[model samples]
Target: MKKPEVTEQPGGDPPSRRGRPPEPIGEDVGVAHRTWLEPVRDRLVASGLTLDELVCRSGYSKTRLSELLRGKGYYPGWEITYSVVKALDLPPWPLRRLWTAAAREADKNQGWIENRIRAVQPLGPELPPVAHLGLTQIMRGPYTAYARAFLQSENRAQRAVGETFDILWLTWDEAVAVPDTPRHAWQLLRARVMSRAAQQDGHPDLRQAAFATVAQAGIADLAERKTRIDTMADFFDAIARLPQDQMDVIVLRHLCGVRAEAVPGIVGLTPAMTHTLDHHARGALTGLYLRTGTTVTIDTLE
Candidate 1:
């Protein structure tokens, strides 16, 4: 096909433009995330620091940091995002809100809020032990926290935590070398943890009957244990309904217990992009939990 050509306007005015038209609004799901990040990136550039200097200060890989500043990724975690803010000594609250808005925009594009799923929760088996004591010890706290956050039963959560360590031990050397940033170890552990959790749990679903039973019970029947299970199930159900990318951010960062700085690489994003996705996912969950008028404290991106 022949390409369109510029031509003189009527009355000898300037020629009409011939280049491709601008992209349609809303075509790019990442636009909002990028828009909010670009200004901070420009400020970073104007500050006259070398890439190595930025890397040294931020503890992010050169490539990843550069990509994030260049607005290349769609999701960045809170840790990385905050690191940038801290590195540059910028105000926190405003940028934090902008980061949250960006994630909201991205999530809206992904149709996360409206999508619903009915699923049967799957339980994963415990992972076998392996070597790499240093790393294993490091992962224990966060991994246990993640398991407790995700699995309803205390025993299952403990087993899932063990499984996370087992998977990491299996490939400890390879994981250690990845990105080699301060947060890399945590990221690697989180990925394996989430992967294992997914494998164990086939699907997460809302058991309305359980809730209904609770609703009809006497005040004495509302034990702390039962309340915890109900809350955990509601969280898991919300997670199951999230869009894939948003869900990944939630699982890896919140459930699997990866640091915000470590989240981008684990989830295949730049730091700023990871922040956006993390914010959106958490915001969604928070809103869902709030509908019941219960105050919830999920992990922050930072």
Candidate 2:
């Protein structure tokens, strides 16, 4: 009789399909969790390690691993996650940061997060200096300024930039592979900033940001201040309605006070494209203001 062929899982473990396949992760799972969880599931599938074998390798029971793989029940702490990640020979830092983000999204308290993190061994080596000095430090200023426009808190803006850098470090290889590294990085930064932005009508609500504008601050009379704010609110609402590229150009060039030459680099667009976006954005804002009969001009926003 011919012998049944046996396949080996990673780490020289024999494959065993004793347990049922992991359940599909539902939409109910937060995006942050799904970001890391989906990759883990892909890795598991690629590894050809059954749930029973994974339990042996990760030192967790089949039930626990199954729940984690499916993203069911309470969010699993970092300790179990680290074990599985190591068992699968996957890099931990990127997934660690992602897990931390998911934990915060889950409203897991800092103490709980810290305790869970401590239960695992210290993370592997620090991010290389090339990633830090070459890209992160250079982009930090503009990224933070852009983030501050939406977040309104210096600490929150800094945190968002820091998280963006962490993600960049983890995905540096893929970032470099792309046609435009800065554009890829900008998208990541934008997502992080937007995730924390105040929402209005399902978009980032920038009307409150008008209160912080120098135009609003210069007004002394309460009646005049209210009028300016109301006008600025309408202007900002129109800004929110602008197409995304044009909106980004207006925000960076006018709102964030970044130089025209710098705006192109930051948004990863050519100088000509950036200028066109600015012109078109200004024109759109002008049209909106004309329709609304507002006296405020786009130049005044500068």
Candidate 3:
């Protein structure tokens, strides 16, 4: 099927967007890629194009595109970015000179670019650029994907803004995995099974390496206070895998620390059922603690 051509009405977006337009924001070409090109990439994302469609027209494979989004491979000559941006039916002339100069400067110091990416990633998960990617799979995602600018490293400042958003969400994912929740039962079922994600060996955060080692040892953390945190994480690996009903109860009881009286509003479980559920969860956690030797800060709970 052929795609129809759509035309832009007048001088672009009518009323000027308040604050500053994202162009000419920086002087040095290298810095401009991070500062200046941001708005350009953002303009593309605001447009409506699917990831797959964007890649096809842009000529860069999905994998390469992903790296660029992560701020890893933004060094390719202007032609590549040009092809991708132009396919959206927008002009790329003036922007070309800016980014072109940025690319040449980028070539001189590739290592510094990746280090900047590392600086913005949060403490826990760091999804690196995919390795061992084939050409076919690489071309599947959008290059100038107007949508991915949401996920892309558009620029350092923009990425810093995004990392903040992830921090809040991660806090919640952590809160929900507590074992006193009916969700804990689901976790006990898989304690030893899910402890194999050792990819954090190269992780920049010490906690990551520490946790990965804990999981591999079937022990979560050795430090007493940190012990509860890690054990909670271990239990969550399994709880997170449970059915929705059970996970909901887990969150109600443990994460939010809601009492049995409030369980009905959240999970629709009767008061009697919630009480029984909490009792069994307590017993399960106590028994697991004794058996697994997962330690917590001494005298803190005493």
lDDT string for model 1 (145-241, tens) is 6545444456755655554444344334445557653254545444434543433245444333234334444336557648855765565666767
Per-model TM-score, in order, reads 0.34, 0.82, 0.26
What shift in Å separates residue 185 of candidate 2 from its native position after superposition?
1.4
lDDT of 2: 0.82
The local lDDT score (0 to 100) that residue 192 gets in candidate 3 is 13
| Better by TM-score, candidate 3 or 2 | 2
Query: Which residues of candidate 1, in runs, are more than 4 Å off?
Result: 1-132, 180-202, 205-235, 243-245, 248-274, 282-302
Candidate 2 regions exceeding 4 Å error are 1-23, 39-57, 88-90, 214-216
Cα lDDT of model 3 by residue, 181-290, tens digit: 22232232122112222222331111232343344455434675366456555654433333434544554455434555656533435677766665655555556556
Instruction: Return the lDDT, model 1, position 204.
Output: 40
Model 3: worst 10 consecutive residues (lDDT sum): 142-151
Per-candidate local distance difference test: 0.54, 0.82, 0.41
CA lDDT, candidate 3, residue 120? 34
Name every residue pair that clashes in candidate 3. 44-146, 45-146, 51-142, 61-138, 61-139, 62-138, 62-139, 63-138, 181-250
Compare candidates 1 and 3 on lDDT and give the better one: 1
